[model samples]
Target: MKKPDLISELNTAINQNIIIEKNIKEIIDMSFKIFKKLFDEFGLELEKLCDFKYSSYYSKHKNIDLDLAIVKYFPKKDVKYKEFLEKILDTLKNLPYGYKIRKEQNDGYIAISQETSSKIINYRFIFLVRKKTKTGYCDYYNRNGIWQEDYALELTKSFSLANKISNGTLYKVKSLLNYVLKDQFKYNYGCDAILITWFYEFFSRSLNKYLDNKYNKKEKELDFVNFTKIKNLKKWFKYNIDINNLYYFIFTKIGETNTYYYPELSFEPLELFEGITRYSVNTNTFFKLPLSYFSHIKVFDLRNYQDVRLIQEMGGEEYGYSKKAWSKARDEDKRYFVSPFIISGPFNYAMFKKWYVLTSNSLFKTLPVEIKKDLNSLRQRESMEFLNMTGHNWISSYYAKLKYLQPYFDKKYPLIKERDLKVLIRMITTMVDKTKQSDWLLENDN
Candidate 1:
């Protein structure tokens, strides 16, 4: 598309309400008003409210259709948090654009929607919540003056924990997180201040850029005027952190025109997280929550919306793990990979690990001696550098389930599609047959 045409199309969308553009500063100001209301109503400490800054924004088309204006909140305790939630709901229920409650149990929502000739749509005002989990989420990364990297297996465990928390949240927990963050980040001094302040500023800035990229007709064009590429290590991570690409799928499958362009205030407890990041493939520059800047902060897909169906239908509570994506064992062989679903078509970190193991074991056998020696000499990172979409001759592994990459595979290894598929299937089959991956495969495989 021509540059002029693209701009004209974007302009037309805005004029027709097909697309809505805002000077991002306006978004920041409007979102703060919502936070201010929460702070005043809860009587939260003024200092903490000051700490809360505009972090990011996201819009989803699902049970709730709203723009989630994310703010960074730090709280000290759950002090009367439950009461604050009750009051907020009661107050909003009386307002003109307030959400109408859909489900009031542990999992439910209150939404504000527009009525059209065909039906009511453009739902917003979703407040999702969750019971405090015992997952490895470190409330304070340096609470006891211990750094995460110094401990054994601590880093990986933290990544795993982050993966768990970012999953979609149910209702009833949104108000608690929103109202309680003031206490979450208030600091005394020294390391506590360093960590907390670091957490607040990085996310406030990172998410700001990440949220602004929604305007691209194809990929989100980097708003260069607003975002700068990360070059300094002071705020950068010590190690490469993995980020989940699930939103790519959600947007492809569910995101539609008009439903999300206009900002309708929403309260989803889940995606508002401050630590998440989205690394750009087009540019090494990053845009996302800065949590990944911490070497130990690995991103995992938290498909929370997947759980709502089970929660609403049964409400009985006994259905348990039976409701998770991994609950169906039979579907693993055919339907597990999630990367192919993203607009970027990225693969999971696990798939890269699998390819490494398989190549070392058999795929590289008798490779001309020079090639074999040279390949073997490469480190894990070196090996992976040659495997990404931008990398040379990368194969479409069975794990990615990317039928779209079949042409690439066919061109590289003509007439071997069946063999490649079989080998890939065998790799996963052996994994399932030999290891205790039933749960891991269920939760993160997709």
Candidate 2:
């Protein structure tokens, strides 16, 4: 597509009023009631409101999906937090499901759920109230000195508990709520200060550069510019915002006119966290809140909005134990590899310690001497390297070691795909059944 044409298309796309999901009304109403009640009681002031809006989008496979969100932002206030939290808890606890409270940083979050019924899956009430003393001093402190940034506070709480809530379900639910809350509270607090600041600065300074000739079209005299410029917008915004490509899938999927462009908007939370990180809850009360929210709202295909590519990306290079295009992709230049093991040696032997036993005992008879000697020599060096890097190597470093062993498997076990080699290594290290993964390598050996 030509630059001007793409610009015109994007211009029209942004202006179009996409439909918000019908069932979302209930969720929005619930959120609004909570926001309003909290604002009134706590003295937090409301600044702006955005009812949910949507836009047209086409998938790589040419599918369509609806995107919807509403935002309610309020001005920064004195936020007389302690007394405010008491009243906030009082309001949520009285709701039918009864409320559960968890201490976060110096503040307390009260989460309440409505029991699953014919209509509602359940409702979750979450609050973060930081204590603001008359003195201008604020740090992460609870009863003790237990406070961190909001994200750090959430991470600390997520790991310190034990609950049956699966990480997959938690990630999905949290992703949705994070989006909603980000949009709603961004302007209110400091939720989107970075993005908004960058946007203003860009338009304020380089207003003409963004308003290039592409925006001039006979069909629409939009005071707005093209969304194609959104790419540059992303690049400039990154100076103030640090979002990763993995979580940028939400925006790319939302603005899907082309299969190519991926905008790195600074609006996602999961981008702020790594996938290896898990979310835990001390009590069922906190876990159930997120579960109830997602379970109740099932009108849309949750998977449709979810990108499997994103799952792989968020999991880092070792996700699914698949290694393809890593050789060239790994280096100081990219630094995409989870660790140096892909380039290290000893970690590989540890991964296949059992397989190494099988190789040394059974396959050594059939394998050539050079391959065996090379494997042993590389293993020793890499192991020492890994040990030097860290006092102790974890299970993950085994992936790096496994890749070095690949050449031995290739010359001796020529039938396996390089992709399958990585899978086999992960399976072996994970204690997966050899019989089941036998199909993964040396298929023609039998």
Candidate 3:
């Protein structure tokens, strides 16, 4: 079926608060302005030629809105990447919306060299969603105005700009077109024309959805994995591994079967960010890092932990003296028991700290030599980023990192009242700190 020519509808959609399908074409047309501006800057070399065969303009364009666009560059001879990246950033300063660089990423001495081989970076920038807004969202939002949550951050992932260097599925045509643009350049504009056709049939829905289906469905989706399922517990008895840092409990609701690791339900709530995927606007599929992979976790259900703790203290008093009292305590603390496995050998707290965002460091000093070596080896000196989402380094503790994401979370999901989010962050941070103190395996690190 042929899609309607929605140019005018798209224009209307652009000005409205809530965007609809009709507005897509207009947004794509507007995005080309960026392309043209870029071409004017780089097209000078190929001016003498009739046309250039290889180009990103052909492969990369708008996915839904300008939210997704390819911004690739190849500097002319003697032009350095530092000059290129900075110049492009300066261009963003001229836009009507606000554009700020992440302070932790590049600042001060700027030790990270811009000239390194092809760097594919995903940059995010904010824009004015409602014409009615008189101020940036952080300050205030007028009752009549609105913030366009979905379109706030425009995601731009770059490809290698280095010539003669293509990595993993990249082709020579993928390089920024420089020399031979007019006469000698490659003209294999293979699937360029079909982009619109493909957009209508397939890409109208984000591709990330397809990739997500086959994977572990964001490990957080499961209420709680069984307490026995973590990596090294089976060997605890045989190898004298310390398991006291592990907090054990089952979070269950009457008639409901979801198992939980902590008493509190949520600590770091998920949020959608602009610039990642399309349906992210329509779903809770935010926060690219899976909960299973997130280290330094603090159990949030404090009320239950306290109740269970009281039962534990009263019951363990008669462990050797009264079998009846001991049995009762075991049953009472069944849902929330502090881990009981005492590790006698050296526990590797240092390595765990280096690789994870753990709140407790007590286990690091006593870890065995072999485990310490493993943790040190998995240091992962580089950044850990995937699916266009990156972690924050501005925080001091593992839990603080999630706490710091509050503003971004509120901006992405406005219905979530800001006050509640703030409270949750604070509560979770406090609970985790306490959990670390209570679970400080050293009490039984024997």
Q: Over 4 Å off in model 1, which ranges?
A: 1-64, 67-77, 97-99, 108-446
Could you give candidate 2's per-residue lDDT for residues 1-446 as a string of tens digits?
A: 53232222222322331223445445545644664565566454322111111111111121111111111123255334465556555544543333233333232333233222222222222233344434222223122233232222222122111001121212222222232222211111111122122222222223222222222222223322342244443443333222222123222232122111011222221111112112222111110000000000001111223423432343222111112222322321221211110000011111112222332244234435554454356454433332222211211222222222223223235433333333443443233222232222332221
Please report, in order, the local distance difference test score of every candidate based on alpha carbons: 0.25, 0.26, 0.23
Where does candidate 1 have its weakest 10-residue lDDT segment?
337-346
What TM-score, to 2 decimals, does candidate 3 have? 0.18
Off by over 4 Å in 2: 1-20, 38-84, 96-108, 114-198, 208-446
Instruction: Report the candidate with higher lDDT, 2 versus 3.
Output: 2
Candidate 1 lDDT over 372-435, as tens digits, reads 3444464434432332221111121211221212232232344333433334333433443354
Between prediction 1 and prediction 3, the one with superior TM-score is: 1
Q: Per-residue error at 244 for model 1, in Å?
A: 18
Clashes of 2: 11
**Best-first order by lDDT:** 2, 1, 3
Q: What C-alpha lDDT does candidate 3 achieve relative to the native structure?
A: 0.23
Better of 2 and 3 by TM-score: 2
TM-score of each: 0.24, 0.27, 0.18
